[model samples]
Target: MQAPSMWRHTLTFFPQFLAALKERAESDSTVTVIGASDGRLVVPLVAAGYRVIAIERDPIALHGGEVQLPGDRTGHAMGLIDRLKREGFYDRVQVVEDDFLETGPATTRCDAVWTSCSWHYSANHHQPLSEFVNRMQRLVRPGGLFGAEFMMPITQRHHMLEHYTSPERLRQYFIGDWDVLLTLRTNEFSEQAHVGQLQDHTHRMGLLLAARASTPS
Candidate 1:
């Protein structure tokens, strides 16, 4: 699919995705976006009336940083969140410039944590994925939501490919701990693009959704 089509597909997923979060989370809930490359999801999320803390490892990923949005085709800006300000959603947004893996578990918990393809970085950096899940699991308050579109290949090896975790391994990491919401395996259909030099193949992936189990009250 082309970029427009891919974006449209993603947009189709967002309504139900946001609806799930809205159903389970409070209107004022704070959401932490892992690898918030741009305001793509952040904008709508803010428009939905939730506070968002956008985290990005690479500072230059935001369109506001001298890179215009996809459709604009004109690069002009200083930071990604500039558009957020222009749209009056900046007050509801926060940017955290830190590596998700290196930053350690957050002391300040959030009502939900979200990520796109970026969640796999920690698994790539750290051995296995237990540490990464533990870190994210700690950040969300119990009963809070944790959602990400995961890259789950049929086979993965250290420094071998971009596929970070297998579906079964991810289950081992989250099942006992979280109440699974959605877990469906699919391929990388966005423009039929290939990723990485060694892997070079778009393998199977999963749209992961789970809610941290609430403590016994």
Candidate 2:
């Protein structure tokens, strides 16, 4: 598939996926944010009256008002937020262009948190995940929602990229702390092969949705 074609597929499917997640949340006044939101796919959630915050590291992609290859991307988080506002989704969102690790602690206090396809890129996944969970616990006020989609590693003959956690690893990462509500795996193929091949294969991708563990009084 062409680059544009692949992007089209992403744009089409991402919104629907987010909608399904929203249905599962089932909350009228959930304050939500997207961590490392590349294409601003969750803008619809804002339009639906949810408070949204977006954080991204790439300035070009964040501010360009158009999605491009991560390498070719430019702009800041506020730029994207401004673009979204111009597009009529500003009422519910704020965008910050900075390292997510730095922002996790301060901004983690929201009713819901959604990290889509970006957790794998964290410099310190463990610390950030823990902090994120803790922040959700504090911000969500119990019975709120947290959702994430991550790339998973799979041992297969033909795969796409690298740097994904295996199923077992992911399980171990969240088991003791979070009560898992859903675990799903799927396969994705890239239109352009060999563009970047740092991994063995790409057969396994994971989605996890769970609420923060209620604090013990």
Candidate 3:
């Protein structure tokens, strides 16, 4: 597929993901947008009236352990929250400046959990696949939804193998513990982009949606 069509198909996954989420969440339900970069899903969830947890490594990435100066920043002071306030959803969202995987399961379970193209950071850092998958199972209450988009490697260069995850490997993480609801994959595209250019290669991205089963007596 050409890059443009691939991009269009790639963008469509979010709404499909959200629609699936709607079937599982109420307007007032609590939603957790893990790795909330630039408030993409966070703002929308808050605007739609679900309280959201906008978690990230920090409100903004720092330089050499120091905060970036105002002029050097590409985003706002409070990251997602700052954007939320401007959009009038400030009071509905909370920001957590910590690693999502390291933060582990939330103390308070939410109605739904979401992430867009962010889980690989934790994987590359050596977080076990089951830990994140099981953590999602724990963070979303029974009957709640968990959704995420991740780029899975069909093949990788020898040096790049350490940081890639395969689709098969990901499925093994959820096999028996949960009920899979939706599984979708997009055409492979050069996984890298630079200044409006795509390299001559590609990788497959898969979407996984599942529900936490109710506890049996």
Candidate 4:
């Protein structure tokens, strides 16, 4: 619910989180990034030497396109991609402007899949989560890893909490299929004020670094 303004601050600590996660990933790994809104997370992955396929639905956020920063939601996605390209990381990433749900998995295979703060956009949370998990399974080889950061109870509305999942529910959804690693709950405050006060909200996130189950021998 916190607007794009809040994202700036949240992203500041992202590098630390990524650094920790990076230790678990192999160098030059192939990672498919879904729902990569503005490439906030994808750029870091690229800089870390991971090959990425970034998927997004916003037209202005296509790979290699120019984007306005801070709050121009339209171009932010593309902007990040362009920045990465300028920095020589584009060689490690492929930018695609398409609905991830519509994009089939036959063209690009990956070693892992990473997503951040975008799943709440799904029309049906359960269905999308299932499809997303299945897609990750397809994109990564058997026993490969899947990682994501999701907003729990997604919303900034004072009276209304939107379609979000708690850490437990998220685990319930994937428990049998993947091994859970970490789940965290945290709070973020935004400059946007509601009724003359800055909007502060809590988000429960499931940071799952799980590996796909091995095929039966």
Highest lDDT model number: 1
Off by over 4 Å in 1: 1-13, 63-79, 121-128, 154-163, 187-203
Q: How many residue pairs clash in model 4?
A: 3
- Clash number for model 1? 1
Candidate models: Cα lDDT each: 0.66, 0.53, 0.64, 0.60
Q: Give the per-residue lDDT of model 1 (tens digit) for 103-205.
A: 8658799999887776566444654467666777788888999877766654436336534655555666676658878776665543322112122244455
* Better by TM-score, candidate 2 or 1: 1
Score every model by TM-score. Answer: 0.75, 0.65, 0.75, 0.71
120-139 in candidate 2: lDDT tens per residue? 55454645455544553445
> Which residue pairs does candidate 2 place in steric collision?
59-74, 59-75, 60-74, 60-75, 61-74, 159-201, 159-202, 162-199
**lDDT of residue 71 for candidate 1:** 42
Model 3 over residues 51-85: C-alpha lDDT tens digits? 98877774342111223322334322334555565
Candidate 2: list runs displaced more than 4 Å: 1-7, 11-28, 65-79, 122-139, 154-163, 173-177, 191-203, 213-217
lDDT of 4 by residue, 1-217 (tens): 2123213455233443465457666778777877765666777787777788887776544534444443333332335466565667767777877776677655656777777766665443545466665665577666667777666654555114333655666666565557666666656433432211234434445455566666633
Q: Which whole-number lDDT from 0 to 100 does residue 207 have in model 1?
A: 66
Best-to-worst lDDT order = 1, 3, 4, 2
Taking every candidate in turn, the Cα RMSD to the unseen true structure, in Å, is 5.3, 6.1, 6.6, 5.9
In model 2, state the lDDT of residue 42. 53
Q: Worst lDDT window (10 residues) for model 4? A: 189-198
